[model samples]
Target: MDRVPQVEFNPMAGLRPAGASFTVFAELREQYDWFRSTVGQGFWVLTRYERILEALNDPERFSSSAITVLDPEPAYRWIPEMLDPPEHTAWRRLLRPHFTPASAAAMEERIREHCRELVDGLAGKGGCDFVADFATRFPTVVFLEMMGLPTERLATFLEWEDTILHRPYEPGRATGRRKALAAVVGCFRELIADRRAEPRDDLVSAALAWRMDGEPVAEDDLLSLCLLLFLAGLDTVTAQLAYMFWHLAGHPADRDRLASDPAAVPTAVEEFLRAHAITVTGRKVTRDGEFHGCPMKAGDMVLLPLNSATRDPAAFPEPERVDLGRHPNRHLAFGAGPHRCLGAHLARLELRIAVEEWHRRIPAYEPDPDRPALEHAAQVLGLDTLPLRWPA
Candidate 1:
């Protein structure tokens, strides 16, 4: 464990055209197995499929304490996502029942109905900003219903989402981010209070009964978990939907296949997820050791861009192209090992339903050439604007 190569890489660079992030990662994957990024306190980038997988699977060696490279030494934690091993296990156990395939299945028809309504409303518009009109709203409605939040506050939630996650982490946005975090924390505090005063048949009420180590979950822990759910629930699916539509809008053959043969949407969803894996998370090295031919030390941040694994030629044949029929597609899009996404089942169902419903209604569409879809690369890769056009 000695000298390490350094690269002037910034994962949180400003917005770029669609697929630019992937292209950058692809070049990095080709050249470097792992390199120390000279961005935000300096972190190692594990660029290969096997290296990233090894780090993700070995949570003991690679802690989830600070799941983002920018904030490797975060002042706070976000419940299950930032927790590791026993603590994370308990939280996952308590929350698993709510996000199981059965739970997602139970809400299938309702999800489909809502997705259809959103699609149908815009079917006649000839063109639309899919990110604003459908992508964000569809998941926000479902998440609000699940958490028992008021639908009337959808606009406010979107505003907070943008400020908290979508913005660049420059000094200019520092105050706005702090204020947004406080607002979210304040909102969750009120929700936790209400749920305690009177329980309801919702996820918030269910959290009141969660126990860790045979004792009631602490108030601070509940707030942390709620904060995690708030960001994760409202944010990830919206990004997934935008990326999926971005792909479908650009690739008509895949879109027509899903539209004509509805049964193909499921596998297509998996492929789209694999190709457009949207999260680029990080892990803090817990102890000093060498890994994947790279020198390591305790407290080092290792970046795990999920797309790097999903798009690795070593893992998937012809990784660049989207093959809807690809099988044994064990991509780390939802992540791997203990920290795998808790909402995976629900997300898959929602994406499947949204694809099915949208293509069924508006079978032919493409990205609006005048207004390109903008993508931001950070902890979570996201689409800012997706202008789509189709014949009325």
Candidate 2:
């Protein structure tokens, strides 16, 4: 394979306008097939739909050892996420039953109940910072309950979530990331110890009983898995919710479609997931190779910007249009191939319930003209603030 001419581009270092991440991705896809970003350690990016899918499916070459480009050579592994092949396969098998459609179905009622409780409180408020007041809290409650953690400390968990995920990377700004990660790990370590002693009927306890290759899963590995869940479970849905609502708030016709039909909410969820695909996961190059002309050496990081792939014009006709009834929406919102999101069913369930329940109560709303949605791009694209208003 011959090395190809590559442009140096940085996707992570920027302030994105409201819902402009998708626009930025569109331009990137039009301009460059791939580029080397010197954002963190430096990584190769695959922007086209076909190539991104190829890399995701071909994990043997594009290893999951380093899922984030920022920390290309991470000191710690997050269990299944950073594991490759058989190890990743085993973890997925263990986790599959817990996140199946039936499992997600079982939680729908509880999810709706939680969604309504939160939405009901906001019904009279006229307007609120939806990100703070609703988006973050809704999934955090459900996640805590699933993990068998005390929901009473919801505020504290939210704080830790903000610190670990929302804090942007700055040069010499390791303190916040390290401190937040330590706090989460320390908290999980204690939880693992407690679950080991008590052995309750929660996900943690279920994980405790897992065996890999006829051996009990190690305590350290358990902590790592829990850490992954903590980061993934709490953050992903919140980010999705932020973007979904932000879209709906601005586009009332889309909002009305969900409110009027009710049945359309499910498909609308899919469309929103497609249009506003948030996650930007990466892979580590396994050996010396060239992917479609770009040279990649062993230990080099490769970014799979899922958002860019989903909106590729080649894949989706009129890619930018948010068609609520978009059939055959094979978007990589939950990713593709061996490492597709385990909590995908749960995420869909949560998003469906959230849209259904919220619009049922607060039907008509729009983004506050004065204070706009604050958008950013990192490992995930999300709104830090979404001020929305309706008639009191």
Best by TM-score: 1
lDDT tens digits by residue: candidate 1, 61-140:
99999887878777778998999998889889999999999999999998899999999999999999988999899988
Candidate 2 residues 141-219, lDDT tens each?
Answer: 9999999888998888778877776677665777877887888889888888899899886899899999989999998
Clash pairs, model 2 backbone: none
Q: Local distance difference test, per candidate? A: 0.88, 0.87
Error of 1 at 200 (Å): 1.4
TM-score of every prediction relative to native = 0.97, 0.96
**Which 10-residue window in model 2 sums to the lowest lDDT?**
1-10
Clash-forming residue pairs, model 1: none
Tell me the number of clashing residue pairs for each predicted model.
0, 0
Stretches off by above 4 angstroms in model 1 are 1-3, 171-173
